[model samples]
Target: MSLVVPAAALGLVAGAGTRWLLVRLPRGAPVPVGWCEAGLAACWAAVALAVQAGRLDPRWAALLAALSWLAVAGSATDLLVRRLPNALTVPALGLVLVALVPAGSGAVQRGLAGAVLLGGAYLVVHLVSPHAMGGGDVKLAAPVGAAAAGAGWALLPVVAVGAAVASAAVALVAVVAGRAGWGSRLPHGPVLLGVALAVVAVAVPGPRIPG
Candidate 1:
């Protein structure tokens, strides 16, 4: 088989396996909403590989992929535990930075800047309106920032546009289903994941998740 296709498939397996491992954590989240975790890893990994091969800028693709997983892993954590834990977010923060070395210097900058922006925003939100956000979410910023910052300034728009669009879509879906009300509580993590992936698609359009 061709290298890209098989690698893509492996990504899917890895994503799903990550989910299974997530289940073993203390969180109470149930089965995933969909194959999102799998999609996130497998899909982005393929892109990362392609970019590394010079099909795209290795740095940008890695940044996109890392951010994409932050959204994915965070969302999944919240879904399972209703809270994002340092157990996951902390290591993930380190992981994101480590993942950038090969992407290039631009990626390294993006990783740093994005992490700062995301963490700072989470902190402000937590201190002022803790209900609107979680401390764990703040911890998630390191990785998110690392990934986005590494990708380039263009990713900033991807994140912003993706977040807005995904939020509206989810709200629209809830309203159509009649489950969410004017003040109903929703899982922001999943919304964030959706937005991140959307940004990736915009940045690096390609096949569906690996499997």
Candidate 2:
């Protein structure tokens, strides 16, 4: 397919580039260059390919996807450092806004709403048990909203349901592997991005429902 070329190529290139950045960047934890790049790139490219196939507008899909990658990277930082660095998060979002002029900035407002919702959810959880949620999650919620909002109304619910399902699956994985325990923190950012991407994939192209 016409889209497959860029999808696969971008996946490889982005993966390699991310690996380079991860290795060269001064950081707290030791992570493999190949592993992180390959993994993240694969996810990005896969989302792109699905979008292309679904016959959605390519530019809109690409724009949201780029934001999604930023979200993924930000979330990865939370997983690695156990903190959301404004140094990284703010700049990434600022760049997103700049690129968004052509794309239109309306989604940014929606993203803010998404962020507020997520922050509120985490806040409630924190009130119930501070240890159950983290401030980093609030930082993580903004872009998920942006991505879904960029896609339009249908995506919000899709993103919510998808993220919840992904989170539960991850929890199940952790529990089955004995990685789950009381007070153990789960990385919600990754799951949020996963839901956004899943919606992207499904919204683009899939089996049609019988009328």
Candidate 3:
């Protein structure tokens, strides 16, 4: 109960750091400093609630927080530069491995396998049509896959479907608003990371404690 405020404060600090990184990174667009700060603050608050409700394993908290940070960082970079840097994505996979260690051998195995599978699938797609998917997204997929599978493999599909649907919807809106034309590419990293975060929220839900 008491941790939520402090967690949110920590998240704001992390978000400020993220905003600083975004400003320093090569970018074609202005960074949304306020949005990033708010997003992480909200994510941390949610994490605290999940923890308080006993829905999330304390052992997995660090992984959850790290994933949240990665999502924000990757999305901002991809949207601003249309590139996902190895700077953000590669270290995320390593962090996933480090974060999942305390969850035991089975979890570590599942996380690694999930990483390979998702990363491989994206790599194949990137090879087939470089225009359709970016290298950054392929790299980003590994950590997201590992995190989802570490929680439970069933979420892999949820992440897939959610991302696809969200992407399509965003594209539709862009077209309708005349901001983009048909077949134009939108930054996909945001949709992927956003859906992954949504899945994490769903996976962590527990019965509400009656006040």
- C-alpha lDDT of all candidate models, in order: 0.64, 0.59, 0.79
Task: Kindly report which residue pairs in candidate 3 clash with one another.
Answer: none
- Model 3, range 1-211, lDDT digits (tens) per residue? 4788999999999888877776675543346767668878888887887788788767667767878888877887787768787767888998987777766667678789889887888899899999878888899999988987776778777886788799999999999999999999899899999898778667745433110
Instruction: Report RMSD (Å) for each prediction in the order shown.
Output: 5.2, 4.6, 3.8
The TM-score, computed over Cα atoms with residue i paired to residue i, of candidate 1 is 0.74
Better of 2 and 3 by lDDT: 3
Whole-model lDDT for model 3 versus the true structure? 0.79
Per-residue lDDT for 1-211 in model 2, tens only? Answer: 5666676677667766654554455553334555556565676666666556664444455545566566556556656755555555545545544434444556556555655665466567767876655665655555555556554556777777777778878888898899987546787766776667667545535334110
Model 1 agreement with the true structure over 1-211: per-residue lDDT tens digits:
3456655666666677667766676754344735554666466656756655656554455545555666666776676667776666778767777777765665566677887886787688779977666677667655665565555567765665566577677777898899787655566666665665555546544332221
- Residue 211 miss distance in model 3 (angstroms): 30
Question: Model 3: runs farther than 4 Å from truth?
Answer: 25-32, 206-211
Instruction: Estimate the TM-score of every prediction.
Output: 0.74, 0.70, 0.87
Error of 1 at 76 (Å): 3.2
Quick one: ranking by TM-score, best first?
3, 1, 2
Candidate 2 root-mean-square deviation in Å: 4.6
Q: In model 2, what are the clashing residue pairs, if there are any?
A: 54-204, 111-146
